[model samples]
Target: MDEMLSVRQLMKTYGKGCPACLDLTGPDHGRNMCPVCGTIVACADVSLDVYPGEVLGIVGESGSGKSTLVKTLYFDEEPTAGEFYLRSYEDGVPNLYDLSSRKKRWVRNHQMGMVYQNPHLGLRLDHSAGGNIAEKLLMAGNYHVGSIRERAVQLLEKTDIPITRMDDLPRYFSGGMQQRVQISKAMANNPPLLLLDEVTTGLDVSVQANVLDLIREIQRELGVSMIVVSHDFSVIRMLTNRTIVMKNGRIVEQGLTDQIMEDPQHAYTQLLINSLL
Candidate 1:
C-alpha cells in the first residue's frame, strides 16, 4: 500500500544550531539542548510513514518532541531539515518542505487537515460553528455559500454537534463541544491526512472517551489517515494501529501498538509503559 504521508530526517531547532547539536542531544544524551551552541532541538532525525487509512500514534513525555513532529508536519512550525511527501500531492514525488509558500498552503488546505491541542488555535471562538467549517471550505476554494453550509451541517452532524447549534459560536459550547466543532472544521475539506496533537488532553475523562470514540468512528467511516500525538499511552492504545515512542528529540522505539505494549524494546519505552501499569 502506498504511504499517505512520508517524512524523513525531519528536524526542528529553536536556535542557531551547530554540528554538535544532533550529536550532543537526544535520549542517549538525556537532553535536547546543545550546550555548545545554545540550540534546542525540538525534534531531530525523525522519520515515519503513515499508510492509507492508518492511525499512527506518537507517545512521549513533555518535551519529548512528539508534538513537534506533528506540528512540523502540519506546517505549524518550520523544520530546520526534512523531506515530507504526501501521496495525494504530486504522487509523493517532490519534497514538501521545498515547496513554495503558496503551494504549501494549497497542500495544507486540500490534502491535509490539522486539529490543534488548543481549540482556540483551530477555531475562531466568536464565529458560529458552521462559519468555522465554512472558513475551511473557503480556503479549499469552495465558494458556493449554499454548498458550504450544507457541507458544514453534514460535518457537524458527523461529529455529533447539533445542527441547531450550527449557528452558535463555539465559545458558547462546552469544552467537548468546542473540540467537536474543531474536528468538524478540520474535516471540512475531507483531506486525505489529518494531524491531531494532544486532542483529548485537558478534557474530562468521560468527555475524552466520547471524543476518542468520535475520532475512531470518523477514521473507520472515512478511511482517512491520521497521526495522533499524545503523552497518554492509553489513548495511543485505544486509537492507534502502530505506535512511535519518542524521547528527547528522537524515536526510541516503534512497532505495532499491541506488540510494543507487550514488549517494549527501548528502556524509555519500557519506562513509559510501566508508568501506565
Candidate 2:
C-alpha cells in the first residue's frame, strides 16, 4: 500500500538554543526540558509514515510529545522544522508546511479530521448533535440542508447514537455518548486521515470499551487511515497493526504490534508493557 502521510525531522521547541539543548536529545531526556535554558522540547527529530487504511499507534506517557505530534499534523500547532506530506495534497508533490493559510485550511476541512481528547475541542456543546455534524459538512462545502441532515442521521446511527436524539445538544449526553457525537462530527466530511488522541480517557471502563469499539467499527467501515495516540498498551494492541514507542520526543522502538508487545527493546517500552501485565 502507498504511504498516505509522511512526517520527517519534526521539532517543536518553546525556546531557542541552550548549550544543554544538544545534550538533551537522548532517552535520558524523556522530560524534554533543558535544565540550563529552560527550553521545552515538545518534539525532536520525529519521523514516521502512515499508510492507507492503516491504524498506526503512537504510545508514550504524558509529556512525551505524542499530543504535540498530532496537533502539528492537524495545524493546531506548528513544527519548528519538518517536512509534512499527504498523498492527497497536490498529489503528494508539495510539503504541506509550505502551503498558504487558506490552502492549509482547505486541507484541514477536506482531507484530515482530528478528535481531541477533550470533546469540547472537537464539538460545539451548545449545538444539537446533528448540528455539530452539519457544521463539518458545511465547512466542507455541503450546503444542501436535506442532504446534510440525511448524512447526519446515517452517522449518528453508525455511532450508536439514537437518531431520535439528533436534535439534542451534546451537553445533554453522557461523556461516552458525547464522544460518539464527536466522532460522528469528525467523520462527517469523510476525511482520509483521522487523528485520535487519548480518545478513551476519562470514561468508565465499559464506556471506554464501547467508545473503542465504535472507533474500530468506524475505521473498518470507512477504511480511513488513523493515527491513534495513547499511553495505553491495550489500546494500541487492539487498534494498530504497527506501533511506535516514543520517549523524550523521539521514537524509542517501532515494529509490528505483536512484536513490540512481546519483545520491547527499549527500557521504557519494556517498563510500559510490564506495567500493563
Candidate 3:
C-alpha cells in the first residue's frame, strides 16, 4: 500500500547551548522556552510510514519522544529539519509541516482526528457525552442538531457506551468507559488516520484491556490507519501487530511485535521488556 504519512530526518530540541544541539546546529537560545539544551531532540532523524489499515505502536520510556513523534507527524510543531505530508484530493500529497495555518486547521479538523490517554483531556468536562461528540462533529462542519444527536448516539452505541449515559458528564464514567467515549469521538467522522497518544494510560489495568478491545473493534470497523504511542508492553502486545521501540529520541528497534517481545536485539529494548516482567 502507498504511504499515508511520511516523516523524514525529523529533529526537535528544547533549551540552549547543549552539546546535543551542536550536531543540528541549533540556535544558542532555544525557541518556545523548551528545556532542551544545545539540540537535544525530543524526537529526531525519524522516518516512518503508516500504511492503510495498519496500527503501528510506538513504545519507549517517558521522554523517549514517543508522543513527540506523534505530535510532529500530526503537524503540531515545526520540525527543525525534514517534512511531513498529508494526501488530499486537490493537493496530491501536500506537505503537512509546510502548510499554512489556515490549511493546517482544516486538515486537522475535517480529515484527521486524535485520541489521548485521558478522556477528560480529550473531552470537554463541562459538556455531556452528547455535547462532547457533537462539538467534534460540529467542528467538522456537521450542523444539524438532530443529525448530531443521532450520530452521537450511534457512536456511543458502537463504542458500547450506553445511551443512558449520554447526558452525563465525563467525570461520572469509569476510566474504561471514559476511554470508550473518547474512542467514539475520535472515530466520530471515521478519519483515515488516528494519532493516539497513550490511549489507555491512567486507566486501571483491568479497564485497559476493555479499552484496547474497544479500540481494536473500532479499528476493524473503520479501517483507519493508526499511530499509537504507549509505554505498556501489554498495550503493544495486545493491540498492535508491529511495534517500534524508541530510545533517547531514536528508533532502536522496530518489527513484528511478537518477535521484538521474544527476541529483542537492542539492550534498551531488552531492559524495557525485563522491567515489565
In terms of TM-score, which candidate is strongest? 1
Task: Write down the TM-score of every candidate.
Answer: 0.98, 0.97, 0.89
- What local lDDT score does residue 240 receive in model 1, on the 0 to 100 scale? 100
Q: Which 10 consecutive residues of model 2 have the lowest summed lDDT?
A: 22-31
Give lDDT tens digits, candidate 3, residues 1-277.
2677666788776545454353543222322223444445676677887777888889998878888888766667666767776554244366677778887777777777788776766888778988889988988889999999999999999888889999999888888888888888877777888888998777777787787888888788778888889998878888787899987677878999899999999888898899888
Q: Write the per-residue lDDT of candidate 1 for residues 115-157, one digit (tens) a residue.
A: 8889999999999999999999999999999999999989989
- Residue 263 CA error for candidate 2 (Å)? 0.9
**How would you encode candidate 2's per-residue C-alpha lDDT over 1-277 as one tens digit per residue?**
1689999899888888677774866577557888888888888889999999999999999988899999999999988889999998887879999999999899999998889899999999999999999999999999999999999999999999998899999998999999999899889999999999999989999999999999898888889999999999999999999999988888889999999999888899999999998
Candidate 1 local Cα displacement, residue 43, angstroms: 0.7
Instruction: Mark the regions of model 2 whose C-alpha exceeds 4 Å error after superposition.
Output: none
Q: Look at candidate 2 and give me any clashing residue pairs.
A: none
Local distance difference test, per candidate?
0.93, 0.91, 0.78
lDDT of 1 at 154: 92
